[model samples]
Target: MLKEETVRALEQTARQLRVEILKMLNTAKSGHTGGSLSAIDALTALYFHQMRHDPSNPKWEDRDRFVLSKGHAAPALYACLAEAGYFSRDDLKTLRRFGSHLQGHPDMNKTPGVEVCTGSLGQGLSQAVGLAIASKLAGRSARIYSLLGDGEVQEGQIWEATMAAAHFKLDNLCVILDHNGLQIDGEVEKVMNVGPLGPKFLSFNWHVLEVDGHDIQAICQALENADETEGRPTMIIARTVKGKGVPFFEHKASYHGVPPSDDELTRALEHLGHS
Candidate 1:
């Protein structure tokens, strides 16, 4: 179990990251807000506590890698990378701006800490799987991590990658599902149900774990558990709210692809204790 102080610190960091995410999205005036907000806590646990990465040496050969499979949540990854010192936090204001490194989707060539060009949806898991295979072949201890959206599971390519990850026994790969239950069109089930996810992944031979996505200690413990498991890739199904922090936005499908307005930003900051 994590110490109380450590858990509080992590929770504080996640709150701060959420603030950054909201500010960046509001600045851009165009970005995915709901999914990004939903995924930030799990990302906070990974980048701040779990993953072994060097911000100054982002290209370090032995470093663990992270892939944002649900690339629309780029703001969540961007917030973590900036906090981790991959780039200037001030650069966050440039998100989605023309020629800014913080684009609508992750681009490895453009972003300092991004591992692969993503946002194609369903392709990032395969890329992560390939990275795991390469690390294993090279005898490197680096682990590969990826995040997926519950709605994204509707894509067949995710399953293909799932099968491949298990077939290769890529024990080094861990994937987290941002099970926020709502996508752009509507509630995930109404659009296309993808529940009973645990059994499905287990059927593909993955080691499955479920947790509250917003609980910092639970997330960290699950990650630690993934590290200790062997002979199969692990799938962490993280149950989360669509818009986590702000009362008005929480679980609202309308906010999925909408950035916060100036007034909304003020309200959000107040709710987040940033005002």
Candidate 2:
């Protein structure tokens, strides 16, 4: 069982990451806000508590890999990387600016901790599949994790990669769905029904786990289970609210790519317990 103190710390860290993501988007005045907010909790649990990585040695041979399959949520990944000490937190404000490493998507060559350039809807999972295959072939214990948006799964490539991972029995691979329901256009169901997600993955021969994405403890437990299980990959469906911590943005697809204005940022900061 996860300790209470540890759960509290993870929860606190997640909230902090959310605030930083909002700040980065607000500073850039252009970025994916809803998806970023939705993903920070899972990203936080990965960087802060789960993945084995050296911020100083990003290319460490044994380090676990992380891929943001839903590349639009780059702000969340960037914020988590900064908080994990990959780079200065100050760099977050440079997001989307010309000459900045923090581009609109996760660019591998540009970002120290980003493993691949991912923004195209369905390509990230394929990249993760390749990483997992490489790790297994090299007899490396390093695990590869990919976080995908529910909406992004509408892409055919996601299913192709899913089949490949299971076929290879890439037990070291784990994929997480930030199932926040809403996408840029509207709710995921109305846009593209990806429902019965758990059964779908199960049928594909994966170990499936579902958790409330906002619940840090549940997320940690699900990830721990994934690490212990062998023979095939695991897929965690993390149910989340698109604009998670901030009341004004919660459940609203309108905020999908809109950064918080000054007034909105103030309210969001307060809600996240920022002083």
The TM-score of candidate 2 is 0.98
Q: Least lDDT summed over 10 consecutive residues: which range in candidate 2? A: 36-45
lDDT score for candidate 2 against the true structure? 0.93
Ten-residue region with minimum lDDT total, candidate 1: 187-196
Q: Which candidate wins on lDDT?
A: 1
Candidate 1 structure quality by residue, lDDT tens digits, 78-111:
9999999999999999999998988899999999
What is the lDDT for 176 in model 2?
92
Q: Work out candidate 1's RMSD over C-alphas.
A: 0.7
Which ranges in model 1 have alpha carbons more than 4 Å from their true place?
none
